[model samples]
Target: EGSEGFSDLPCERYHLPRPMGRLGKFILPNLLLPRALSDRIGAELLHVVTPYGCAFPTLPVPQVVTIHDLSPLTFPQGSSWMQRAHFHRLLPLILRRSRAIVTHTTRVAEALSRRFPGIGGRVHVIPPGIPSLPIPAGAVPAGRPFALHVGTTEPRKGLEILLDAFREFPLDLYLVGEILDRAELEREIERRGLGGRVRLLGFLPDAQLARLYRAATFLVVASRCEGFGFPPLEAMRAGLPVVASPASAALREVLGPAVLWAPGSDAAALQEGMRRMLQSRETREHFIAAGKAWADRYGWERFCDRIERLYHAVVSGPPRGQGSSAPMRLSQRPDAPQKETPRKREIGTA
Candidate 1:
């Protein structure tokens, strides 16, 4: 499964010019400008893999990009006007120019195809692999039994609903992520008298997160939408059952039957779901087994194989036509290699 761009060792650093935050990112030393400069220095194909979708560079070389989500457009309330305007100006152009486009989940691929019909055949679903971190012996967060919530305190995360749900139960609510909507969260914390019970442990490293996951009763995701839900999958890898909102198509698709789905992104639904999980040990264990088995199906090795193939195809193929072309749908590689190799197909993207 090895390839030129696929390195298992620690990544070598590239000290590209850092762009200033916000609107300044579109000017000199912009997000893509450093990438263009890097392209000139290196023979690597530009792969805009991050959630920041507007970073596709203007270069002579072949390019591939991963559009994780369209949250800025679909859920505009969570994004700023500058972000909305930036996406509007650059997203379509980036999609059109990219040699291959990847989405984190099939849900995202379908959504993107609908939103940008021109990008139909180019889109491919490539769910991110769960990091296989060794669980080291460490102190779990010393507290009462808590329901863990991981992610930034954004409106889309539905922290309000989570806090509201916490009022119904005695279980402590432990939130670990950057506090973006601090004032809004604090107000609810105060109003609900959850000062001590609700712990906002901001930005824990992976080691610390592992500890927190071990200590938690279950993972709770109240997000209104997601490109690909990582927390539930991560929790499953740790043999932890999940209580998640089903509003996100990506989350629903990724988690499948692994998570104990909350009926909606509301306080009542979340409370009911958590109550069920807390009340029944059998249910939790069943989900835990299912989750672990489900998580095993995805790994970095498989993702790398697919990505490596895409890079090779893009470099070898001619410039794409405007019309739709068949995607390079990769099948699951066998545990052992066969004597006769399968024929590689002509996959084009525009």
Candidate 2:
């Protein structure tokens, strides 16, 4: 069962409880039992997992829950009421019952610890791995420079700020994900008279996305909060520099000093930062080198190895004489605490 589909992995492999219509919700529950039975028969049920925000049937076997982010809790306005309710009511129960808790970054781990002090010791930070894709070999085109922005359009993504910044620059802007507020964003673009320069290439395929990364001058991450910033690492893998807000702890932990930091929801600061990055050759080269080095640390093999070890530790116990893996070094910067603003929207920008 483990090796059944090794040669042909599906493109969009979403887990159940996805955003679908009434029929999907009705049929999904029925499909689970038979699938779970089949998994049990094949002895692969142990690998079946659920996230912390869902309801699970009572079973004798142990379970693990991965908490990707707490955005719904931190920025409730970004989520639907039902989604927020589910996380608030069901997540704590799930956490208490889980044999272990997995998170992507240390920032999230710390947040989880602070929120639910009970699971402080058991929570683990197993960062997400980037799967290597074939990079297209060629010299990137000149006179067509643009900044890449990935992720859904939401108040938390700081898209408004990014758009404002791009308007100030001569270069073009490429938005590469689904827009949740299509009408509002389009209205904003029209209002700002940025129709010609701003392009929305919604949800490109993986191959195309890789090409986009290679083509881009740099990637911009203006998110107000994130459990882990995947696009920055993806940008790094493509040897692209990253310009990001310091609002996300995961970005700070992962990218460190490699990424150019701007204040989230500050249009003036974002505009200044973007202009500075585009103008400075030395700054761009420094970030490119630093980003590539940072991205190299997170390969799928290393991620899988850490996960497998964690599974063994949970099933049996921690390795003999091994202690906790929490980071020993803390940030010495005076501005670190000032950057931890909760949630604020930057208008007229990305």
Candidate 3:
């Protein structure tokens, strides 16, 4: 049912094959195939779905590639050569034969349309849904305040810029996610004398993360590019306001007018945004309410319904026009001049 690569491979291998097999079916060619060889042999059977926009080897089957963002194409400096090469080689064909191109946000849909004209009608926006977590009334902490950042360690994540801006604020900065660049980040923290104030709490379990979100004041995201930007949405579900970068269109699309946007790479601008977020109670309350409403709009049942419809459309025929029953409930927030959680104090080094 699935092949090995990196991210989705294990999930496919361990879970996918068993159910299909139990239902009196077996994936052809029992041996695991190398990615390259698989691309060649399974070309006819391939239906490539990925965030990166790239063409794969000539395939006979309908390729339903998912474009998360045009980051590699739009911001080449932050991408690896392998990623760049893969996208460059596969994007054209992927776009050409894609039965239904899926994207996480509307901004990406617009970008895809602008960059590769005539395909706007084919693109479908399927925002990621957060698993429902039980919310206890009055679970939110009264006055314990902290700014949260969640993501892997990477330059494009804008962690360095966030640190620079964070120094100006008095609030504690708690980073929750795996640290991919331990030495580099530690060095930066040391250089900036942020040892005590800025804490990097590596990946946390869902329950713990929820508790942290409940306790936190607000969530902060400073990514240069994001396909979906799950953390802010997750934060919003927990009833927290978000302060994020304007560089990520996905963040802007999902958070809408609820977020406080700060310019990427501008420490001064980030500092100003942070100061305003910390000081304005009215702004905080407004965002909290608006964010909750926005978060509720992205129901998983609705998202799945759209996906199922798109799948049927892709298999049976071409997609309907863009304006045809807008798949998502567009945020009603009036577009203002751009841009733009919570959780524990646990640290881990990797």
Candidate 4:
């Protein structure tokens, strides 16, 4: 879904091959590829947009990089030490040199601006957009009322907290994502005696997911933090009431008062939030309406428009520093875009 926002945009895409692991992250993109391939295009380029935070090469062209989140810094346990170390060494340089930086949420943009001083002006908060989904022609999943949580079983997602909260709750809990920490999650579920009640659907296609969303009584998002909380927006788009944790600044900012917010990591708060949504028809209807309204505003059109404007601004603006070797004119520059297959891509806009 990260690349879906650009599907409708008026720009060419170049799906380039990348190397594996450390070689791709450190050597190939940053050093080898540019020297070998950049000159293949006949015209000069206005800006090289890196969807990821770090640039692949030390290119002479202007750059616009996107930082999805600071999860490695905030939740260090979720990633490897090597990955964290790589970011620690390279992020500062990337921030300092990039012409423009894009982030999915204003909270992240603010945090990034604060972390890397003097780049506040360059930080752009262009939230991810959700495409309009036509409700599938089928019956909602038949069963007892269930609260759904859709994301990978990562520490940062706060799935453990959700399990704890659901321990005493009567309703079923449905989790829809690949469990990275499968053994750990299963152990926790067994320890809590929630084996029968909690269902792990693993990864589902869009059609199945849409059906699950429609079938759900409500959606519970207990993520501790995020670059942008898409599940809630997706839930909202499906006309589902959301019960979200207050810890997710991105969710609080994006969904606003539309969701039933549960405080901290407390199980009781989650229980209360879920209960309120289930028992109170007024509350459920209100959130459903508000959530759909809020989610509707963040359509693909608006997302593409902001991105296009940013591209134009970067292309048309004056070049940075006398030592920099950015292209002089937009017309003389040729565009080259890249894309990654979305088959199992879970992070970001997805």
Please say which candidate is ahead in TM-score: 2 or 3.
Answer: 2
Measured by TM-score, the strongest candidate is 1
Estimate, for each residue in 1-350, the C-alpha lDDT of model 2 and write its tens digit: 12222234322222333436543432343344335434533221133233432235443344557888888888888988766876777677667655667888888888988887667666778886776656776775666778889898987898887787777687788999988877889888877778888888888877788888888888888888787888888888788898887776776887888788875547777766777788999998988998888888887666766766666555554222112333222222233565544221111101
- Candidate 2: global Cα-lDDT? 0.69
Q: Residues 38-121, candidate 3, lDDT per residue (tens digit)?
A: 443333223335643224433334446678788777777777776676566646555755556788888888888787776766
Tens digits of per-residue lDDT for model 1 on 1-350? Answer: 13233444434344445456665545432344445445544544667674343334455566678888888889989988887886777777777777789988888888888888767777877776777645949565465788899998878888888888988797998899999867778888999988889888899888788887788999999998898877778889998899998888788888898889987778999999999999999999998899899998778777877876777777777777654566644444356886865433221111
Q: Rank the candidates by TM-score, best first.
A: 1, 4, 2, 3
C-alpha lDDT (0 to 100) for residue 115 of candidate 1: 82
Model 2 CA deviation exceeding 4 Å by range: 1-57, 137-143, 263-265, 317-350
lDDT of each: 0.76, 0.69, 0.66, 0.73
lDDT of 4 by residue, 147-235 (tens): 89999888889887899889888789999987886777778999999998988889988878888889889999888878888878988
Candidate 4 off by > 4 Å:
1-15, 42-57, 321-350
Task: Judging by lDDT, tell me the better candidate of 1 and 4.
Answer: 1
The window of 10 residues in a row where model 4 has the poorest summed lDDT is 341-350
